[model samples]
Structure formats: structure tokens, C-alpha cells
Target: MTRMNYQSARFLTSAPTLAQCPPDDGAEVAFAGRSNAGKSSAINTLTRQKALARTSRTPGRTQLINFFTLGDDTRRRLVDLPGYGYAKVPEAVKREWQRHLADYLRGRRALRGLVLVMDVRHPLTEFDQTLLGWADDQDMPVHILLTKADKLKSGAAKSALQQVRSRLREWEDLVTVQLFSSLKREGVDEACARLDAWLADPEPA
Candidate 1:
């Protein structure tokens, strides 16, 4: 286990402008996914704190990039990206959100990894493929979390994971994938374990 603490974390907001970001000293792990993909739930589960990321019954509630700081002011952060593929949001607003998201993803120097959450029932939408492609172009490590696994039986969950793996094999970008359910508390520790390993190592200078 990594000898670290997750203390004093909070949701900072829906978007990231130049003035609203945390200092860029430490590595950051960002979360990107479709709306209602259980991102808020996964984030809360990871931090072991309820309401830390503000779950919404409605998709597209998170319209901006939310940032959460972990383990003191040493600069480690968990970034929550705006949910894509939600049809209810205005086209203009979604476009703006996409612009900001792309700029951040392509340009941020402190970003170390991205945790892409997708619904297990409908994993790997077209938007997901584009996001994975963007990450691949940047040579970023991606960890996919198939959320809402509790909605299905073990057999179904296994099959779903295998399906995602097969789809990923077609992509030239190699991304690691896992299954999780916030309601069932499944794969939470394993997800944290992987993140801990990444965060424990210092970024190459």
C-alpha cells in the first residue's frame, strides 16, 4: 500500500478556465466519460466520501472540468471532465465544453493519466473512441472503468468486460480496462491500488 493520505478533498466546479485551476506542480489523474456514466459515484467511492463529487439524477449536470485535490497541498489532483454524448445539453454549450476539454487534455503538462468511465451496459460509444484516440495521440495512459456492473449478474459482467477488451484490441491505443459498480463497492480498492502505484512514482524530469 502507498503511504499516503486522502484528506480535505472537494468539488471545485463545472469548468476550468486559466484562473480556476490548481497549481501545476504534481501529477493529475483525470476522469472522462459520457454523462450518467457513474463518474460522480465512482469519484465519491474512490475518495470514500459521499457527496464529494455531487451525483446528479440528470445527465450533463457537470458541464465543466471539476478538480479535486488529494493528500495535502503537495499538488496531486483528480480531474472530473464534462460528460459527453448527452443529447439534452445545448449544442453551443457542448461545443464550448469540448473546446476547453480538448485544450486541457492536449496541453496540460501535469496530467499523468485518464480514467475513462463508461456504462457497462453501453460501453464504448463513438465519443469514447474519439476520446481514446485523443489520449493515444498524446501518449497518455488510460484506464477504463466499466461502471454500473451491479446492474448485471457476474456472468453478464464478465461477458461485458470481455466485449470491451475485444473492442479495445481493435484500437491501436492500448488502454487498460476494469469493471466496477459504485453501488456494490466492486473494484474500488483495485482501482485505488492502480492509481496509488501511478501517483507514488515521481514524474520524469
Candidate 2:
């Protein structure tokens, strides 16, 4: 199969619940991360389109599972899951989002893999570990992007990358980590390459 031109990605639909998502017909990869972790910026940068995922100054602005299709094929999709760990949101609302997120991650058969974004300055928080554990339980592959790499100095950024890579050694075969700076457009190709690999496969094994 030819490499997908993510630049041709277009917004598909936003589903508040897994039941409302598009039919589970094709391979899909979901992007997940903590609130204000640069998930939106990384997605926009990956697709080479500004505002594709709706970046916002406020954390937790993405409150739904937003889908984007590559080219015109509905089978291939990139899902933007709601950002977690934003304390400002009400407890009831947060619980509801968490329930929906858990259900989708555990039940979505078409979900081929996951892209977990995190800030380089603060990688692997408690919530991140929880998600990783869940992925492990499902035998799902994950590619972690240490977003906002520009915020740290070169040495610090390298150290952060190595640290995360070292800590994830047990899951090395199923997990990959890379430093990414959406503002600098760094690591966009690498990130997309992983996404393409997942999408190319009929199902993640």
C-alpha cells in the first residue's frame, strides 16, 4: 500500500460515546494524552494542517472522541481522545469522560494502536502509567511522543527521552518513544511513519 498523505486528512465526526463512533470497519489509531500535553498541536503538525484538531489555550478543551480520515477512505482514521487529568473540570464530568474513554479503549475492536503524547518536562505521570497498563493488558501497541521538547534544553530533552525509553524497557517490543516538538515541526515524519505502519496492518497483533 502507498504511504498515506496525512496532509489530506479531513475531520470526520465527533463521538461522545463509543457507540456513536463510526462503524468499526477499518483500522484506526487513537491519540491520547493528559490535558495540555500538546496532543492537538502534535496532531495538527502531523497532518501538516493548522487547526485540524482544534488546539486551545485551555486544557481539556477536547471533550469528545474526534475522528479524522486520511484522504477519502473512512476505513483509515485517526481518533483524538479527550485529554485527561484536568482538575478544573467537575468530578462528575471527569468520571463520565473516564468511563467513556475506558469503554472505548477496552471495547473498540477496530482500534489498531495508540499514540500517547506527553510533555517532555513531565513524562510518565500517574495517569500516563494507568494508560500504559491498560494498553499492556489489551496487548495494544503504543507510540509515545514526548511533546513540547523545545521547552527543555538539548541535554535535558535527551535525558528525558532516554529516561522514558529506559523505564519502558519491559514493554520495548510493544512500545516506542520519541521526542517531538510540534512548534518546531520536529519528529513529524517519524510519528507519521508509526501511524502509517499501524494503519497499514489489517489488525494489530
Candidate 3:
């Protein structure tokens, strides 16, 4: 198996709905989180690009499934799923987004794993648990990033990580949790290692 060159990533396409997504022929790991959870920032940081994934002041600006290629290969992809649970979004629209997210998670064969981002100070909101339930139904492996770790004191951050891990102990086999700070660039290497494992070609390369 070969590890991908994440820094070589470039914008591939964006699909307003899952049906419009690119051909599902190769491994892809998706980043998902609620609005303002630092998902886009993490993606940008991971790819070592200032704007690989757009960081917006508006929390729910990402309304599409954004796709990016690993290096020059279209087969290896990184997906930025729509940000969910924005309070200002209309309820009907929120439901529609949830439907599309559910459809993709349940049906996307190319999806290898999910990187679930949440603010360290507010990890595992209601929608986050809902997302986790969907992942459990699909038997999808998840790596939980307690992002914005720098906002809390060092001891507080570690405690938050421990709490998240403890809360997810039942899912230990399919879920993992770690502290991450996009601001401090902390845990970038560890996160990339998980991505490497998930994005690596399963068959002989």
C-alpha cells in the first residue's frame, strides 16, 4: 500500500447532492462536523495549504460535498461533507442536508472512514451523537478530533480528551478520539497517521 501525498491535493469538484458526487471507484475518507467545528481548518492544515479547504466566517457556508484529489490521482480523494447543525439555517433545509448526508454515509462504497470534528469545549453535541449513530449503523470507522484544544488549559484539554474517550469506550473497536488544535498545529502528525491508514490503497499498489 502507498501513502498519499496530501500536500499535492487540489480541488476536484463539489456536489450539491450525493448523487452528483464523483465516480466511487477508489478509497476516500470524509471529514464531517457541525458548523464552526473547525472541520475546514483541519482539512487545510492537514493538506499543508492555506486555502485547500475554505475557512469561512459564516458557519454553514459549505452547502456542498466538496471533493479534493490526493496528488494527481483522482482515485484517492478527500471529501469535505456539508457542515450540519447551524442554528440559523431553516429547519426544512437542515432536514434536507441531513437526508443527503445520511444517503451518502449509507451508500458511498468508496468511503473508508470518517473524521468527525468537534470543538474541544463542546464535544459530542446532540447532532454529533446522531451522526455517530448513523456511522454505527454503517459500521464505519471514525476518528474523533476534539478540535480547538488550545482554547482550554493543558489539563482541561487532556481531561476533555479523556472524557470523550471514556464516553466512547463502548465503540472502542470502531471509534478513536484525540485532542487536536488547528491553531497550534498540534496532533497534525497523529491525525495524518490515521488518514494514512484509512487512505492507503488496500490492495497491492
Candidate 4:
């Protein structure tokens, strides 16, 4: 498996332009989810860095595609997609954001897989389903990370995981589901393992 260790964030850029993305190297694994999904915290936790991916107190702070290189000089790009579902953003701007997000999701040829982070308390939502549908249409591999698992009791967390699994299993398209707790440092290795496995696999034709 390809070992993943966050080296540093090279730069942060908008999605419509990919203004900060590194030149094409191998493949990019993107993190996509709603605002306040604990994405930044989870990313920092996974990388074992306290403040690698900036955690925003306000939702929708990340308005673009933020790129971070992992490992050494020969590093893979970790794309942090802008958070969706914030009602405060203007409609016109939201649509424009969607346009950029859609363009990336629809056109990025080197996209290997997606890390779909959902709040464990809420699991999946309508918007989440739409994103999953889009990924299914593209035949992209998706790994769902149920974030904030530590907030729940052990039994509750297990039950939620099963519930999410059953719901995903019902879908015609497949997805891998895992629990994560960035605050408690739980499941970080598991998340990394999934990423490693994908990185080690042969590229799709």
C-alpha cells in the first residue's frame, strides 16, 4: 500500500481555476462534504499534524479547491474541496460554486477516489445522495467517513455505523464506509489504510 504522510500544504486555490493545484503527477484523492462537517479537523488528525488543514470556525470558509502535497518531493496531491450546503452564501455565488465543483467532479481525469465526510450525528442527507449519485455515474470509488464519531456513546456509534452501512448497501452502486473522530484521534489509521490501499492499486484504464 502507498504510505501517506502529510508533508505540507503547498497552496490553497479556487476550484474553478485549480489555481493552486500542483502539476499532474499521479492521482488526486478529494475530500468532499457539507460545511461544518469537521473536514479540516479530520484531515489534520489523519496527517498527525495539529494544524495542517486550517479549521474554520465558520462554515463555508473554504471557497475553493485547496491542495496539499503528501509525503516527500514525490508526493500525491490531496485536494480539499469547498464545503457545500451553507445557506448564507448568495444564490448566484452558490450556483457559481456548484458550477466550479461540478466541473471538477465531472472533468478531473486524474481523480482516483473520493473521501465523502458526513457528520455522524446526521449521517447522509439529500445533498449527500446527489453527490453520491454523481460519483456513481462516473464510476468513481467512494469512501464515506462518518465524522465526529467520538461524540456518540460506543453503542450509539456502532449502531450509527451499521445504520449507515445498511443504507449504503441498499444502493445499486457500492461505497466503502468507515467511522472517524478527529477530536479523539479515532480511526485515523483506518482512514489512512483505505487511502493507502487505493494508492497502491493499479490505475484504471
Q: List RMSD in Å for every model shown.
A: 2.1, 1.4, 1.7, 2.4
**Candidate 3 all-Cα RMSD:** 1.7
- Write the residue-wise lDDT of candidate 1 on 1-205 in tens digits: 5744544566544455634666665777888988879888898888888988777788887776788777454467788888888848788988887777778888788888889999999999988888888888898888999999999999999999998898888553658899999998899877887777667754643
Q: Candidate 3: misplaced stretches above 4 Å?
A: 202-205
Q: How many residue pairs clash in each candidate?
A: 2, 0, 0, 0
- Lowest-sum lDDT 10-residue window in model 2: 196-205
Task: Evaluate model 2: give its lDDT.
Answer: 0.91
lDDT of each: 0.80, 0.91, 0.90, 0.77
Query: Of the candidates numbered 3 and 4, which has the greater TM-score value?
Result: 3
In model 3, which residue pairs have backbone atoms overlapping below 3 Å? Answer: none
TM-score per prediction, in order, is: 0.90, 0.96, 0.96, 0.88
Error of 1 at 101 (Å): 1.3
- Roughly what TM-score does model 2 have, to 2 decimal places? 0.96
Q: Could you give candidate 2's per-residue lDDT for residues 120-152 as a string of tens digits?
A: 999999989989988999999999999999999
Better of 2 and 4 by lDDT: 2
With candidate 3 superimposed using the best TM-score fit, by how many Å does residue 148's alpha carbon deviate from the native? 0.7
Give me the displacement of residue 170 in model 4, in angstroms.
3.8
Ranking by TM-score: 3, 2, 1, 4
Cα error of candidate 2 at position 178, Å: 0.3
Model 1, residue 116: displacement in angstroms?
0.3
